[model samples]
Target: MILIRGKWRTASVGFLCTLLLLVFLATPVWSLVSRSGDQIIIGANEVIADDLYVAGRTITINGTVNGDLVAVGRLITINGTVQGDLLAAAQAVVVNGTINDDLRVVSQVTQLGSNARVGDDAVAAGMSFESLAESTVAGDLAFTGWQALLAGNVGRNVTGSMAALELRSNVGGNVNVITGAEGDAPEAYPPFFPQPPVPIPQLRAGLTVADSVQISGNLTYRSPGVATISQQAQIAGGVLREELPEDETAAPAPVTTIAQQLQYFIALVLVGWLLFKFVPNWIQSLAAIASSKPLPSLGWGIVTFLAVGIIAIAIAFVTFVLTALSAITLPVLIFPVLGLGTLANLTLIFGFLLFVMFVPQIVVSLLGGRWLIHKLQPSTSSNRFVSLAIGLLIFVLLTAIPVLGGLLHLITIFLGLGALWIWIRNNRDRAPTEPQLAAV
Candidate 1:
């Protein structure tokens, strides 16, 4: 019996070690070519059989990728072929190649060169997007951006929300657009648009349909002003102009004023300063834990938020039932039941408010500050106050932006809450021993 037990123990230990090894080395079992550098180029003669993942300042693919191609960089250019989906995020993305599957890109400027062809749908979002005359999309085209110039061939529908739109394309299906208000168009073309790395045509800030356009289906647009449609433009299903909804037609509320922003910034700084002063070590540890495993922290953060909300609702329902039962059958138990219910509900409310008001901003700011400091001055010892100040300022400025600010705020909330949960869980796991505090 002893001999058999020893053999089993050995096998279990070996298996555990193998599992740990695989976990630590996170490379996928499938074929993948992942690389990051200042610049990444796949030469014309090169062909990758596996999925390609690349991150760099500049990424140019002149060869072929049989599997999906995912790229992140400042500038991305695809001059070859991607047999699978092409997903890219960059400052500028210019595609002059062929994508056998879908093409999804988010960038400051997304341009489909004259020769560019997408076998499937094309979805894009950014400051500006243009599909040159000879470009072709075998499926639908969807875009959301400041400006869009489509002169391509779309097999299906063309749909988007844009400040300005110019369609000189041949659409096999419908064309639908929601454009900017009538008087919102600037006096000059590209008035607010940033200069792209690659040159693109200047477009006026309203919908324009040129004579070259041919639509097999209806041309429907919703705008405060009428669209500019050339007399010769062909629309098989005719044109329809939809009225703006009442809510949309109404004037928008003013964004936060300068005074309001200043007050918010001051309040945040004060709160952050007090927290750092009282619990420096705790703050540092939380930041460190979150930074150590960012992706996991984000995932856990989302899960925790959902769980907390669900649990809160359940508690509320149970409390209501218990209180009603006590009131009807046992008057004496009513006080106790009501008291407990009120206490639990109050605790949950306060905790949620605290997290929403401060935790996310503080955590995200601290992390950002730490990164910036480390990058700028690697040799200097990190000071929590300094980091918090720097990060808070940056956060305030960024969050002040319209659309982008809202997104950043949401992300920070999740990431911050996730870090806090992770730190608390870690402390609980080490309840028997003194928790080790790591410096930020």
Candidate 2:
């Protein structure tokens, strides 16, 4: 029993440690640092020399970051400087300081304050993007969202796809926009008609160029109606309009056929056979642990499953950051990045297939088979092969039953996974120092 417990603990610990090691190895810990919390603030006097990664509910960067800054939060405000590129995602983003490189942001509302400056391109995607007067983007400005109010200056082009674009700015190069067409105005209700308590602001679609705007190059736009260009606005090149394409309809989800089910069943059977043939003892031990303490097993399984998902996400996010770094700085790092990504992907896929898709079902079926066999034929109850077969057959059949099957399958997976997790945790440190001299 001690030996069995030790093996279970070893297995769980080994699997978790392997995933942690992979993540630790993949990250560029020497060059980057990270922080997360409910509210994160980088004080004005503080400075981070390495690339910074941060996530929180509210994030404020008043200090200087000598390297790239990547942030995600509910409200993000950068009041100091970023010596390198700035990549941010939040509900609202306000940049009032300087970014020596590109600024990439995704948010509900993105604002470049009057003192804001970007040494390179400024790319933003959100519901509304506003570049206040006096702010400047040294390179091109790109935006994709519902409304864009450009009152600042652009060193190069201004390109965007939006519902409403109001430009009261200066562009050194071309201005290209894809904006919405004018929709029918709301019908006027009778004077005595009751109106809604709160008034909803409506957006007037299409581009609106103010008299103060200046474009050194051509103006190209795609919209159903002509753009509103002020006569006082300066444009060195001619204006061109392109036709807008119609929206594509989404396709319906594909239904799983009977053949797919048969194939899946066969695959599970083969996998079970392999496990039964090589790790029969391990299987029986896990079943025993699960049967003895069902609740604990279920709880552990839920935690493990969630942990695995979080690990996979972390791996993917790290891969993306590494790929970006390789592209920006060290091109040679691409080889290692690719290899790491591939390995991580394979590991995650295998883990999902084994733990989520197969292990739970197998464990539950085995337990069920043992229980049913003991009740029906006590003499043959110890026959592992016969027990597994009976359990798996019944499990598969019940899991094939329409609505109830899905719920039952889900419950079985949770229970099985929990049992495995419990066994590992309970026995990992209980391994015997030497071979047993006698059997129980």
Candidate 3:
């Protein structure tokens, strides 16, 4: 009995060491580490893969990158391509890129070109976006600045969280704004209308414009400031912002920002060294299951998603091919197939999201037994199906709304990917015991 007890105790220590190593190794690879760029003056034809994180004086981006960017400078210029998220904390941030993610900036002034294309959301927290007709933001547009003059298209929703927010673009989605201290009849900002630009003070945010400020939606400003109507900022949705004081000073520098607080966020480790103390076997079993059936669930999700996307693309391609094949003969079926395919794509998206939300839990529960799910929440895992059901129910509830739901899903994807990666290392310390192997 003493020998058996000693063997089990040794196994427990090894298991804990393995878990600690896993948590440590996984932390660094997945983390979005901040790395400062060396050059100050970025040229026009350069493309970058990693995110440009800078805390220097003046930085200009005239290149393309596949990651997010965070820069703090006096004059920031972006005239190339950024395929991911962008967060600029500076006096000025200029854009002429094909941005594929969200953009958030805290600057005195912001500018966009007529040819700019932002694939996701755009939020300017400091000054304004005053441009001519060449820039494009493909998602929701939110600005909290002294004065905003937008003259392009925001593909989705729009919001103005500022002293004075103005929009003059076509919206592909709804617009929402939370205004500060407007007049007596605090009307909600207008939506889907073309409101002519009004005259306000030349609130210098020190930015440029690409499109004419075509105010399609209603423009809501505070009751007392004189607005300047340089050009018609036509918008397809409403614009709402705070009522600016007639007398304005330089907006105080971003006092508390995300960049400043990220260190504490990334460094504060939650997984202690003793992660395998209570559920050592669960970890061992998870490792085993992960190593074997690791890719099936993840691959299934990705393949399903991509297959659906490809089908949609094929349908569009077929439509064009038919149109080219015979403009007269193909007209009969092109529109019908195109419409049906588009609808099917939409339905598939919702279905895919639902599947991704719950499939991993179900897969793990089935393969690892009630033991694994029970490890995370023992009290509720009496029935394995019940555990899966409850988890899916919560996911469904959270994913029904747009903003909150989308965020929840994105975080879930990250966690799932992390877990799958961890599963790959399951057998590192699990060499067979002599007694167990002999019995097998």
- In order of appearance, the predictions have TM-scores of 0.63, 0.49, 0.39
Q: What is the lDDT of residue 249 in candidate 3?
A: 24
lDDT of 2 by residue, 311-376 (tens): 888888888899889989999998799789879878876977677688677766766666544433
Q: Which ten residues in a row have the lowest lDDT in candidate 3?
A: 266-275
Please give the ranking of all candidate structures by TM-score, highest first, separated by commas.
Answer: 1, 2, 3
Give one digit per residue, the lDDT tens place, for model 3 in 1-440: 00111232234334333322232122223433233333475566665657555545567677676677756566677777777777666656777666787676655567777777788777664434565466788766766545666667776655554444444566565544433332222122223223222222243232221245444455443323434434444544444444444344223223333233333222211111122345334433443443344345345435545666797778667656765555566567766766676677677677656544443333332223333233334344344334333333333432332233344444344334434344434346564421110000
| Clashes (N, CA, C under 3 Å) per candidate | 0, 6, 45
> After aligning candidate 3 to the native by TM-score, how far in Å is the CA of 432 from where it should be?
29
The C-alpha local distance difference test score for the whole of candidate 1 amounts to: 0.74
Which sections of candidate 3 miss by over 4 Å?
1-39, 178-440
lDDT of 3: 0.48
Leading candidate by TM-score? 1
